[model samples]
Target: MPRPDRPTRPSARSGVAPFHVMEVLAAAKARQRARGDALLLCTGQPATPAPRRVRAAAAAAAAEEVLGYTEAAGDPALRAAIAAWHRGRYGTAVTAGQVVVTTGVSGALILVFLAALDPGDEVVLARPGYPAYRNTLAALGAEVVELDCGPDTRHQLTAEMLAALPRPPRAVIVTSPDNPTGTIIDEAELARIARWCAAHGTLLVSDEIYHGIDYGRRCASALESSAAAVVAGGFSKYFSMTGWRLGWLILPEELVGPVTRLAANLTVCPPAVSQAAAAQALHPESLAELDGHVRRYRDNRDLLLEGLAAAGIDRVAPADGAFYLWADVSDYTDDSLVWCAELLDRTGVALAPGVDFDAVHGGGRVRLCYAGAPGDLAEACRRLSRVTGRA
Candidate 1:
C-alpha cells in the first residue's frame, strides 16, 4: 500500500533529460523583465512568419471542407508531392509509398526509433548534436551512444568516427546541416556512412530537415546510397512552417508497415489542416518561396559570422548551412551556463549554452541562432560585444 502523502513516482525514461536552452531562456526572460532590456539570439526559431504561400495554403485548408483525419501514413497526394519535390531537388528517385507523414520531424524520429531498434539497443549519435536525438532515444528505451566530434571535424559524424566505436550500433543517427554546429556532411562521407551502416546491418536514420538551407554545396541524402536509411524532414526550417507542425519520413519499403502501425497507435495521423497546407508546401511556387527563405538564412549566417569575428569573438565553427553559429568561448569562461546566464542578465541578449548540445565540451561553448532579422542580428552582436566586455 502506498502512502497517501507520497508523491507519485516518475519512470526512468521520464527522467531522461531537459533541453537546457529552455531553462536558460526562461531565466533570461525573468532577468529581462527585471532589467527591462534584452535582445534574444538564443532561440533556434525563425523570426519570420510562415511564407505567404504557407499561410494562404492554411487559410485555404481551413475554409475547404470538413477537417478530418487522413491516412495513417498521410494524404496520398501530399506523399506524392513530397516524393516529387525530392526528385526535383536532389535528383533522387523516390515514390509516394516510401513516405510516412508524421506530426513533425520529432514524431518522425520517434517512429524511426521504434521501427528500427529494440529495447536496450544502442544507437550512435554525434555529441554536441541535437538534444532531441538523445532524449527521444532514451524515452524509447534505446541506449544512446554519443560520439564526440569536435570543431576539428566541423562537429560532424564521419565514417572514421563510426568505425572507431567500440561496437557497431543497432542504428546510427546522422544530421546533415546539423543543429547547433550547422555542419553539412559531404556526399562522399554520407555515402561511406550509408555503405558502412548497410554492411553492418545498422539502420541509418538520416535527418535532412535542413536540406534546402545550404549555402553552396548540394545536400546529400542517405537514400541516394542505401535502402536501409530512414530520411526525416519537415517544413519547419526551410519552409518557415514551424507552427504548422508538419513533417515526414521516407522509409524503406519493408519498414513502412511497422512505421505506419506505430504512427496509427501514437498519433493516428498528423493534423488534417496542417497536412493539407503541407501538400501546398510541396508545390513549385511554394518551394520557390521556401528557397527565398533559405537564401535569407544564408545571408543571416554570413552577417553573424562577420559580426562575431569583428566583435573579437572569432572562435566559431564554419556554418556551411543551418542558421546557428557554435562558438568556443573557453577564453572567456569555461562554464557556458554561467556565462550565458550572466550575459542574458547583463545585456538582455539570450544565447544557448553548450551544455544543451554537448555534455563534454558544452561547458566552454555557446550556440547563437541567426534566424532573426538582419538588423536584430546586428543589434544582438552589438549587445553581445558589450555584455562580453569585448565592445
Candidate 2:
C-alpha cells in the first residue's frame, strides 16, 4: 500500500561511488599488455611478495593442514601474535583476548562499525584521507563528517580539530602514514587525540596498516593512550600479504564479543590457511626479511621525489611515510580524472586522481604511489617532465 522508494530497483547503498583508481588500473594493465611500457603509480600495493618465511609457511600449511574455517575470531596463535606485536612495538598492555582477526583491515572496519555504531551516528574523518573509510561509513548509514585538514597540521586531524567540532562525534578514525598524503601523525598529537576521545566518550578507530613502512616517524598506537580506543590493523601493508587478506583488530574488551559475533555471522571465519600462514609473518626471521622491503620503498620514494621535482611536479605533501605523494595539479588541469586519463594515454603512466580521495579541493590534485619499481617510477617522471616542457 506504500509508495516504494526504490520502485523495485536495487538498494540505495549500492550507489556508493567506486574508487576511480580501479579504472586507471584497468587501463594501465591494458596499456602494459599492448605496449609493455606502462608505469603504474595509481595503486597502493607493494610490487613484492609476502616474506620468504611466510610464503614457505603458507605452502607448508596448504599442503599439510586441513584448510577449513578457523574460529570466528581467528586462529589463537595469530591473535596472540598480533597482540604481542602491539605490546612490543607500543609498550601497550594488549592481550590476545582483545584481538579479533578478520578477513582484512577492510573487514575489521566493517565489523567494528556495525558493532559500535547505529545509523545516523556521526563519524568524523579527515578530507584527503583514505576514500574507503568515507565510502564504507556512508554505506553503513553513518553520518560522515569530513574535516578539512591542511599543510599546517600535516594534513592530519588533531585534538584541536575535534574540540572545534560542534559536538563530539560518535566515532572518529585516524590514519597515520595516511594514503595519498604519506604524512604521519606525531606521537604527541596522537596521544592528545586519544585522551580527547576517551574524555568525550567517543570511539577512536586507528587505522595503522602502514605502521612498519614509515620513513622514521614513530607510529604510535591508540592503545598506548586510551584503553577505550580500537585499532584496525592488517598484514596487507607492512607484511606484504595483501592477497592473503588477513587482518586483526585490537578492540576494547567490551567490543570483542560484539565484533566476533558479527564476524561469525558476516564472514563465518577468516581464511584458515591465511591465518596459519600469517602467524609466520610475525616471526623475527620474517620481520628481518620484510625490513629489506622497507628499504626498497624508501629508495623508491626518494627517487620519485627527485624526479618529480625535476619535472616541476613539486607541489606535494611531505610524504613522511607510506608510499604516496599527494600533489596539487591545479596548474595543469581542473579535471583530475581527465588529467589522469590523458597522462596515461600519452605517457603510459597512471596516477590516482585526487578526487577519489577528497571530493573537495581534489579536482587539480593527484596521488602518485611510489610502491612500484624504481626504474618505472623514474620513467614515469621522465615522461611528465618532457610533456611539461613542451606545453
Candidate 3:
C-alpha cells in the first residue's frame, strides 16, 4: 500500500516553461472581454481558413475509409511524397526512407531531442528564438545554452558564435524564417553553420516550419549539406493547416530506427485522417492553394512593415520571412511583459512579449504577428500608434 503522505515522484527533466506569448494573449482576451472591446491582435495563427483542397481531402478521406493508426514513422506514401517534394522544390536528392511523418513540428522536436541527446547533454540555441527549443531541451534533461544573436547578425546563430562556446554542445538548433524575428538565413551563412556543426560532431536540428512563406530567396534545409542534420517542417504555416496537426521530418538514416521506436511508444502514430488529408496537401492543386496564402502573408508583411515605420516603432529587423515582426520597445519601456499587458488593457491591442522568446534581452522588445486579417492589422497598428503616442 502507498503512503498517503508520500510526495509524488517527478521526472528529472523540469517541466516545460510557459510560453509568455500565450500568457499575454490570454490576458489580452480577458481584458477585451472586461472592457467590451471589439478587436484583438494577439494571435500567431492565420486568419484565413485552411485551403479548400486540404479540407476536401480530409473530408473525402473521412468518407472513404475508417481512419486507423499509421506506422509510427508515418504512411509510406506520405513519406514518399514528402521526399518528392524536397527534390522538386530544392533539387535536393532524398529518398522516402529518410522522411518521418510526425504529428506536428513539435513532435518532431521531441523526437529529435530524445534521439540526439543523453542526460546532461547540452544543446545550443539562439536567444530571442522559438521558446519551444529551450523548453523542450530542458524537459528532456538537456541544458539549453543560449547564444545571443541580435539584430546585427540578422537574429541568427552563426559559426563564429558556435566556435566561441566554452564546450561544444552535443547539438545545435537553428530556425530559418525564425519565429518572433521572421529572419531567414542565407545560403552562405547556412553552409558555414552546417560545416561547423559537421566538423564539431554537433547534431544540427533545422526548424523549417516557415519555409514556404519567404519574401525573397526560398529557405534552405540543412539536409542540403549534412546527412547528420534533422529537418523538421510542417503544414501549419504555409499550408494553413494548423488544426490538421500534421508535420514530417527528414532524419539521417542512422537515427531513423531510434526515432521510430520513440514515436511508436509515445504517440503510437499520427492520426490516420490527418495523414490522409496531408497526402492531399502534397497534391499540385493543393500546393497552388497554399501558394495563394503565401501571397497574402507577403502582403500582410508589407502592411505591417509600413505600419510600424509610420507608427515610429521603426527599429525592427528586416522581416525576410514568416508572419512576425520583432520590434525593439526599449524606447517606451524595458519590461515588455508589463508594456504588453498595459497595451492590451488600454488599447485592446495584444502582442507577445520578447521575454517569452529570450528571457535575457526579450524584456526590451516585443513580437507582433501579422497573420491576422488586413483590417485587423490596420486596426492594431492604429491602436498601437495611439497607445504608444506615436500616432
Candidate 2: tens digits of C-alpha lDDT, residues 1-391: 9876766797788779889999999999999999998888899998889998888888999999988988999989888988888898889999999999998999999999999999999999999889989899989999999999988999999999999999999999999989979999989999999999999999999999898999887888888889999999999998998999988899999999999899999989998888888988888999998898999999999998889888888889888898899998788888999999999999998999999998998898999988888888888888998767732
Q: Which sections of candidate 3 miss by over 4 Å?
A: 1-12, 31-38
Which pairs clash inside model 3? none
Segments in model 1 whose C-alpha atoms lie over 4 Å from true places: 1-7, 31-36
Give all TM-scores, in the order shown. Answer: 0.96, 0.97, 0.95
**Tens-place lDDT digits, model 3, residues 268-345:** 998898888787777888788878877888898889888877787889987998888999988888999899888887
Residue 12 in model 1: lDDT? 68
The predicted structure with the larger lDDT, 1 or 3, is: 1
Scored by Cα lDDT, where does model 2 land? 0.91
Q: 277-316 in candidate 1: lDDT tens per residue?
A: 7777666787787788788888888888888887778988
Q: Which number leads on TM-score?
A: 2
lDDT of each: 0.86, 0.91, 0.85
Candidate 2 colliding pairs, count? 0
Q: By the TM-score metric, which is better: model 2 or model 3? A: 2
